[model samples]
Target: MRLRELLDATELGLLLLVGHDTDDTDDNDGIPPGTPLDRTISAVATNDLSDPGRFLTGGELVLTGLAWWQGDGDAESFVRVLHRAGVTALAAGEVEHGLVPHDLVRACRRHGLPLIAVRPETSFAAITEHVLRRLHRRDPGSLAGLAALVERHRRLLTDRAAPDSVLELLRHTLGFDVRVLSATGRQVAGARPPLRAKTAAALAARYLAARRAGESAPHHVTVGGRPYSLVPVPAPAPVRVPVPGPGPLPHPHPHPHPAELGDWLLVVEADTSLWATPDRELLDRTVELVADARAAREQANTARNDLADRSLALLHSDVPAEEIPLRLRSTAQAVVSGVGYWPRLQFVVAAGEWHAARPVPAAALRVLLEEALLQEDGPVPVSSEDIAATVDGDRAVLLVLVPGPSEAHPDPALDHAALERRLSAALARWLGPADSVSIGVSSPVPEPGNARRALEQAHNALRIAHAAPGQVTVRGPEDLTSHILSLLPLIPAEARRAFATRLLGPLRDHDARHRTDLLTTLETFLDCDASWTACAARLHLHVNSLRQRIARIEHLTQRDLSRLETRLDFLAALKSG
Candidate 1:
């Protein structure tokens, strides 16, 4: 098929972003607009890899979502590789940027490669299918007829099946075992020999990584010696996970940029390439139904999130003193209604930033927080909307269950430190090049009346975290207290190192200069509570040798170790270092 013919198809909505604009003008250095792109399009391929050189050959039109794109240098390198690979033309998806990047267009033009711009309304799958059908000489009119048939089949399955059955149309009538999975690896629906949680999450990760890397779906893999195909349930327009509110939810983007962690995958226990043509089309239609299911699920989450958000707002509002308790209970009661008796809520405030110059949608912070929670707690107690999270400006606010302290569990039900670590890791998995996040947590609020104060504490902790220099920062109420060294998470690495050096600099320098073990001696000495005999026993040194090392430390640092305050200072410095 000719490039012009492909561009002319209304279904594809393809335009020449560069390479002699096709607007029938004599603007391309006196050449006609459509004259240059009259060459035949041999085939179509989608790739988002920064170096797709090994995948491409000559005379093919390559499609890209530009997810791998980071800077002008990236565009130049991609175009250079494509030029060497001898691809006929390039089509860039507007999914990420909402428009073809000028840098890419410049690079393509510089390399004398033709560039096509895909409209935001169109997906890479649509373009690939359209071009392939055109190349195969198939009738486009059959699409509507096929849709009608799929609808008839879908309705029959839905009518006969239970709600929450994913791909029941395929699982029941067709005898094709299929399952749907979320980003957290939760099996939304499936048959026997269920997908293990870890495996499902790994599969989801692979799919998401490929998509972000600009790879097309139907990602194939094998497990237990059986082949399976993972198809992304393409994100529906106006993703349902919107900003929660007392009023109607606000629809931000018309696409699914913010819903990566919420994306669902359709898994079939057979290679998609081996499927018959008719079955493939049917599977495609079934995937649409799954997307609708996902949307509905998100809609429900949005409602509960709205309720929680409203409650939080009400708790913080300057309403009549007598009404504050009632207002807080009125809204939060629904969310905590099903929790165990003596239920308590803890507040977590989070914020994120894209490492690149691009702006991350503030609302995505809510989804990121929710997904992070899912990774940590799983589905049992932390199901959808169970932990209410909402976006307030650039930050996300979440209310998480504070496992009630009981006789059986004397300690707090939650481990704040472990939660912080796990949550940081989980949040990182869902992001792209964006590597950093800051989270602040407040102590559990025993009663609804304390919700507003808890939020304030979380905000204060978040401020401290934001000022800290770290890739991932997590701070809680405990960090706001007297042991200043424990607040290291709220200190820049450079400053922390400098502080350690200032206090223990003499010992570290002396140890290094003389090649002695004074630093270790001091640490062990402090660790042993300044007991000379115990410190000597632990270090396998005689008491005299241990005393000499301590003497050297005190002499070098000009501090009296005999004083308890001096001992504490040295201990704190040693720990900081």
Candidate 2:
């Protein structure tokens, strides 16, 4: 707090005795004309001891009754000790002496201590109470309101209230909308018509960058045609799991989780740089409250995690084929899980490494997979149609069931390519610059007995992904449909690159400059045997559109698509690339 605020409170009848040279003007309501206060007061101390240095800490506005001073020399010595104690100012009361001694003012000036005089009408108790109240930037009543608000939020969580309900309460109290977001562009909870996916992704990037730079938040950004303030929610405290050992007293918390990548974020539409101190504190409280809610939700998922463990064990163990579907009949999957429904499994095998940080936990990847699988538009659900577990250390296996609400449900096939795209994006949110993950996606299998083959396929794709470039790489069933892909990885990467780049470099460059999908179009056309009707139908384009694109491709690459050798050459290049 500033001394100026205290002096400006006219009822306090406080006067600046030193630190300013100003005319005693009545025009400013019995106050001085020039600006006087500069330094800030951290706290208020009331003392009357001759040697009050021992009683004081720094930046205190020392309140006294002149009981320690008897003469000019006494004043100088007293002031010297007060200065030594690092007090910001001295406010001597006149009740005992009937006046502030001129010697005290001279000593204070000599020691460069600002002197404030407390009028007899204002009690020292009044100044102490006032400064203490202002220290927190809010009165006790306002502080109580914040505490009460927190209590209400906790009650909401206990009652199993929706996250949005609590967020709505905050909107009413804060007079602003606050959103909760994850690193993968999923709006965990917040205001209506939640931030666009692209906007959330950009905000997450800024939040992570700010944290990596050791910069304080709320970080400011302009996205979705408006400015927003973002603050990283506190990373959940590492939970210490007991080590399983023969010893009765094993080392505690052997594997505490302190995963840094997938943090929750608090977002506000207003620019926080212009907010008041109290508002900033409120924003900080938002982070804390949101973090607490997230923790509670995660804790509630312990049962689901156990089910995943059992289900994945059944898939891997030498159990009967029929036993797998029965084990999978649980709430872990978002499907009906009814007796009539059969389970279809899509295996995702993901493994990653972190150089100087904690290893990415299998549970963390499970959470990311869930985020990639299900999106909640009404109430946020943590996981649905997704069950994941760690098979070996650091390798997470996610089992996603193609949801069939009823036995008659069509469109039950999982879109492998779309899943690859979503999952790669999701993992990017969790991997740092030095971190890399290899993700392998298996083709969906119809029967529980086929899960073993599906698992093997996933592992094969994972091996390919590990050999590929980039920190986050995904290799799925679609990428391995051809037998050539299996042998392509055995070739030297340099040879593969030289061959592909030579044949496909022109098309790649043309597509890059034009933002066209000519390369993909060319691949689809060759796969369809250059049949314009078939390629057009598969690409969701008209036959004429296909013709025009093929002509452009031929013009760019100087190759005739009608020739069998040319088509084979492009096909090989696409596979190698």
What are the RMSD figures for all models against the true structure?
21.6, 19.3
Model 2 ranges off by over 4 Å: 1-140, 213-217, 234-258, 318-341, 356-359, 376-391, 404-411, 416-434, 483-577
Instruction: State the number of backbone clashes in model 2.
Output: 1
Please state the error at residue 373 of candidate 2 in Å: 2.3
lDDT of model 2, residue 142: 48
Residue-by-residue lDDT tens digits, candidate 2, 1-577: 7778888888789888876644232222222223447567665666666876644546678888898778777888888887776677789999888889999988877766778888799887677656755665644454455556656676767754546655654443343567887756678898767877667777776665565445566788887777888877654443222222233321132222324345777888767776557656766766666777777776665555565566567666886754654555543344334435445557788776553333456545555555555644312222453444444556677766554334564324455455556545544544456667678877665544345556767777787787777776778655655545566788898898889998899988988898999999998987654545557879999977988998998998899775545765687678778
Residue-pair clashes per candidate: 0, 1
Tens-digit per-residue lDDT, 1-577, candidate 1:
7777778888776888766643332223322224547766655666666887754445567877788987667798888887776677888888888888889877777767788998888876566556655655544454454356456645644443422343543542233468886655566676656787556656676666555544567888875676778888744443335433334222221223445544677888667785547657777878877666656556666666776679767866788645765667656665556643324667888876543423344555566566556533422245454577776776888877655556765335335555565544434444544345678887666655456656777787787786777656878766544345665668788777786889888877887889999888988866554545557878999978887888888888888765545755676666668
**Model 1 TM-score, 2 decimals:** 0.50
Identify the leading candidate in terms of lDDT: 2
lDDT against the true structure, per candidate, is 0.64, 0.65
